[model samples]
Target: MSLRSGSFPRTFHASLQLLLTRRFGTFWLASLLSNIGTWAQQVAQPWLMLSLGASPWLLGLDTFALGGPGLLLTLLGGVLADRADRRRLIATLQSIQMLCPLLIVGLLLHGSIQPWIIVALSLVVGVTDALSMPSFQTIVSTLVDRRQLPTGIALNTTQFNLSRILGPSLAGVLMASIGAVGAFAVSAASYLPFIAVALWILPRATVQAVAPAEGGRDGPPLAGARAVLAQPALRGAVLTVLGGSLLCSPLLTFCPVLVKTVFQADVAQFSLTVSAFGAGGLLGGLLLMAVDPARDRRPLASWAASGFAAVVLLSALNPWAWALPLLFVAGGLAMTMANASANAWLQSQAPAAIRGQTVSLFMLAMRGGTALGGLLTGLTVSAWGVREALALNGLLALLALAGVRRGWLAVPRPTLAG
Candidate 1:
């Protein structure tokens, strides 16, 4: 009878069945497919760039292209998300994303693919992602009820992590066989299902029209950002998350290099590293789902952050090829706990009216921190070597742990309604 007890309500089930009976399920499935394709392209594009004689600097540049725009544009996108119909905005952005891969494929097919083109296209994708991501978060409110929100978010992340596993593995095979362009083609086609699902869905049910702001000027654009930052708990969580992301996000980009240079492995080996990280993330998500931290998330987040730091440090010292499985576990747990905690905290604190903008600020911190970390790590690895680069990341994690200990990064207690 209890939703948390793993027993579904008959009414809820019936509602779900009805929702899935038409366009809702189709859209979710299509979104999943599109996401997987996007992940595939993410892995393949970087690999393709490296193959074309890109240096570490260029690799960092590529990461910048992918994340920098989000940092710059997400606030604006968040404003737009609050003002627009989220579903329509997402559909339009996704349609643009569909064209990105097509252009990449065309260039590849014509034998004119280059590192600059890859960088340019990656920037375009990043821009589209920046525009769509806020709407995507806001649209989730329409897909399910308040009680189901946490589960829905968890499932969505689970799907993303699953793609993190499948995409790289599939890309490795496809790259080895039909080449990177073939991988790009698959990513291109992934958008069609999502587009179709969007078309099939009843616009009336899913597209909630946002009312215009009451204030004449809509207040300051930065009002939301400033309000969120003013909350000590929220600010702490955001800071801790930024630190963790700086340390964690680079693993995806730099792991390939670590595999090739440090382990002397091939593309499959690189893909396997990514799979390990994803597997760990998947495990972490399952663990979080099993635990109830509503009473107190601060300690949980602090412990997770501390544990993550220790794990990364240990992984850095790990010798032997067998150390990889451990790295996978570390990667998974670190990402799952840290991200879910921050998201849950933000979601809990944010008012529905500005929820999209709040989430955008959170995302900006995430993507911006990640891009900065990747760039810094690339530079560090070039100068100090992989082990040292990883060690530096571990040090950042330790610094975050200190923040938690000093009460500088406390989680906000949710205000309960009577």
Candidate 2:
């Protein structure tokens, strides 16, 4: 079967059904709840900064606070994943994640809230995420049979996009009905079910044996980082992740600014824009889930890249406010499909022992790229203007596509079931 043609054999549905029937369904529900809270906080935090009289530089700094730690800490977390129990690590990190929102809530309740406080709390959340993400990616294989790994990844992206739909709209409503503090409190409360879910999951049988360090070296965490950076495929994956992040991740950060400054719309309009984007992302996720990775990887990646660049360029044209929903549709589909495809490919190609490290590298590239993109966009908005800055972003995205076409990045063929 030609992967580019999009036809799948019978085995695809059978494997997908087996995956959906297991504990994976329960896990997906829990993840959805937790992800909603995370997304709510993501929307609230930037708004909080804006309310506190922050400048564009300060706003960019806020983005850095939320993503910079992943660049600094994910590699170390990956090394730990190779050496420890991933489930336990995730549980502990989730517990730490709970503290971030609670801290924000306390500050809000006391009327001590400030931009710096939001920045500090965002740093804490980023730290926990850096530690948690790698282990989380590595653990999915343990939750389901290998044949269903792609399905599991697609479903995970689907749930996250679902949360993207729920979180921003809910945050807007909560902020209007109560206040930012109330939104933070709800976000804190959402963490409890995830904690419960983490504890309740039955431990799976260990699949891969841990290998000792080479030459019994017992060196620092940097050794594993060096090893991963040395591999050509891993390096390409990391760069691809960076490219995707630069093109896509800034939408969430800039949406409020776009709604407020460019559209001259209120909070409700902002919420609708976010929801529309999430709806598009949800559609992309479902479309990806329905397809067979072995038969769809290459063309999906190519299509997603080109589509993302095109949508970004079109969005930059500054269409009428009535066209916001269409913009969201384009942005959402481009973001989710491109990201999910890259993630699936990365996870499949990574060696079992270094899977966590490899994933961490990917996460680092993403976070780093987002941080840089947010900063640059903020500056460009202050200087050239929003439309021009967005156009520049689209141009950069097109450049990334050229890189992919030139073989600077390669998506590997998906493995088939026996």
Candidate 3:
């Protein structure tokens, strides 16, 4: 149950090499640039809703629009990833993703920025994102050595968390000074470097060749999904994601509401709070880079999920100065540790023949869980209020994930060797 075990310097050096090397480095550059814009848009999107006097339910619907399509499409996308050229498929998706924000910009400029338009545009982006999700994860594994996956995924999370620090903070400033239109423009422009890399810089050949599946029954998406769900290990990983996406993630979804209603803060304070979560996630990602989740993923994951639930519950109770740090820790435990470890652990147990399908299920589960949970959480907020909703999700996740501690602790873990 150990994919990698090593010292701090070993992990650090691997990270440096992954960033400095050719293909992975290029991927890193494009990801960094694009995520900055994405994060900026993330901030602007909710703010836009509020400016239009949207309700908390509508705000939650925005997330649903963005992630809902993945529930149905990502598994198919995963099957396609296994069958087709992932690089080309991703490049096509990138083109589609690029066009989405440009349309949003036009809406912003023309003063026709209706909520439906926002929701539709977000749906397009989300569809592309969900369809390409497994390819994106698989692409990273191809970039580094197989053994370095733990480090690679951790570093990837670190990059995103770092962008959380930089991008939202920048978006807050830009929104304060220039307005949300500029934020959309920045997001539109951010797609260029990634398109360039996907078009030319990434290797022409598909990264790896897999042997044919043992059974010819793998033809259908349903069949592949069934194979995925039948595996006990994958089931556990999916549950971890469900806990994070459903229980813990509503904290971020409800951030704008918290800032506006509870804290009575403006744009800058909102930005600072966003950055706090990112900063905490960044630290957590770095810590994950050093350790091996394969060693004791079950317990670690259970604890992270439970810890995140507790933190979210606490933050909801006391929206004070300390809430910021609590949210930061929540991001780490809920997001970085939970997701990165799940991805790594799932990949370890997944067979190469159905790797794409497995990762797709993972992607779909994560995204689907988030969308459903966001919708439920939004309704909870609408009916009961944020504190009650937060407490409910927290208590439910805690009871579900950590309640049967001995049972989960006794569950078998994936091996180090893939």
Candidate 4:
């Protein structure tokens, strides 16, 4: 955690060098802008739903709709990532995703928008995103050398976290000035740059055919899942992430419900709360960039999970508007660090042939747990208030942590890999 360490400068320099490269740099910028747009839509959509008199359950259902498809399709997406042209695959899927926000914009302008309509459109976006994300996640390996892959991923995470900050903040301004319609419009426009980059800016990131793994290129979609579970380190990381997503992630999903119902707050407060989490996530990404690339990330991930659980507990027990942002900051930092460390380790360890499938499994644990958590939490919130619901969720996360700790702790320490 010390920035004064001698190796920090070299690690930081390495990270910077990777980011400055043309292929990765262009993709990073595009992804950042697109993520910002996505986050803006995230903020606007939930607020719009709340404004339409949606209940906590409906809000949760909307989040589930946006993430649920990953459970069913993410592994298949991985197969496509490994066997298909990743660049074209991402470009095409994202173009489809872009339509979801545009549809919302059109519906809103026409006064025909409803909460269910938003949920339905979210399901559409989720499906495309589920299929595209594995390819997108694996693209970093193609852009940067294997040695620098961890740093590249850390930088990639940095852009996403940065968008988390800027996007919600931008949404706040736009919503205050022109309403959710403006936010939705910006979200739609954000996809264009990334689509352009995938199609043209990075040629090597594209691949026409992939070498088969242990199985043929056309092997079963769940083959990757089996291989991942067979490895102690991979299995542990995925399971930990499942608990993290199921318990901690819903806090972000239901932020509007918490602010409006618990604090009697407005969009500005909601934006600030989400932005605080994003700021912490950005810091976590930066910290990861400076970590020694050769170090074992498993311990770091475990400690982060523990810290994240504590923060979740604090948020529920404290439950004050003034303290919410600080708790959220800590929560975001810990969770981002945990997830990113696990991600870097997975990408580094998995073989090239199954890399896409491996990443898809990670996405499944993350997105699927988040989706299910949102739905369950929504039901809980409807029955007992947000505070009580979060308290229970936090406790459950701690218990789940205890159950999964052995899998990660038993992982053999890793050496530097190229």
**Model 1: residues with Cα > 4 Å off, grouped in runs:** 1-27, 198-217, 293-295, 408-418
Tens digits of per-residue lDDT, candidate 3, 1-418, equal 2334556667567667777887877888788888999999998899888888888898889899888999889887777666667768888898899888899889878888888788888889889988887877777766666667777778888888888888898899889998998888999999888878766654565534543342112354455556656656667777777767877788888888888887788878777888888888888788777675335566666677677877777777775854665566565545777777777777766655566677887788778888888888999999999888988887887787775444556666534224
Q: Give the alpha-carbon lDDT of every model.
A: 0.70, 0.72, 0.76, 0.86
Lowest lDDT sum, 10 consecutive residues, model 3, at: 209-218
Return the lDDT, model 3, position 126: 85
Clashes of each: 2, 0, 0, 0
Error of 4 at 244 (Å): 0.1
Residue 398 CA displacement from its true place in model 2, Å: 0.8
Between candidates 1 and 4, the one scoring higher on TM-score is: 4
lDDT of 2 by residue, 214-255 (tens): 201244555555566665544555666687677656666677
Which lDDT value does model 2 have at 339? 72
Clash pairs for candidate 1: 280-332, 281-332
Instruction: Using lDDT, rank the candidates from best to worst.
Output: 4, 3, 2, 1
Ten residues in sequence with the least summed lDDT for candidate 4: 207-216
lDDT of 4 by residue, 1-418 (tens): 4456688888898899888888889999999999999999999998999889888999999989999999999989888887777878888889998998999899989999999999999899889989999988988988876678789889998999999999999999999998999999999999999899888754644433433333326566567567777877778888888999999888888778778878889999999999999999999999999998877788888778778877877887885888998988998899999999889888888767778888898899899899999999999989998888888888999888877887678868432121
Q: Taking the tens digit of each residue's C-alpha lDDT, what string does model 1 give over 1-418?
A: 0136543344334434533533445555676787778877877887787788887767877887888888889887777666665657777888887888899899888988889988887788789888778767655555656554554555556666777788778888898998888778889999888766655552533322433441112555656666677777777767777777778677667766677677787888777777777777777665555444233445556667677777667666777666876676676777777777677667666666666677787778778777778888889878888778887788778886686556754334534210
Best by lDDT: 4
Candidate 4 regions exceeding 4 Å error are 1-4, 201-213, 216-218, 413-418
Error of 1 at 23 (Å): 6.7
Model 4 residue 381 lDDT score: 88
The candidate that wins on TM-score is 4
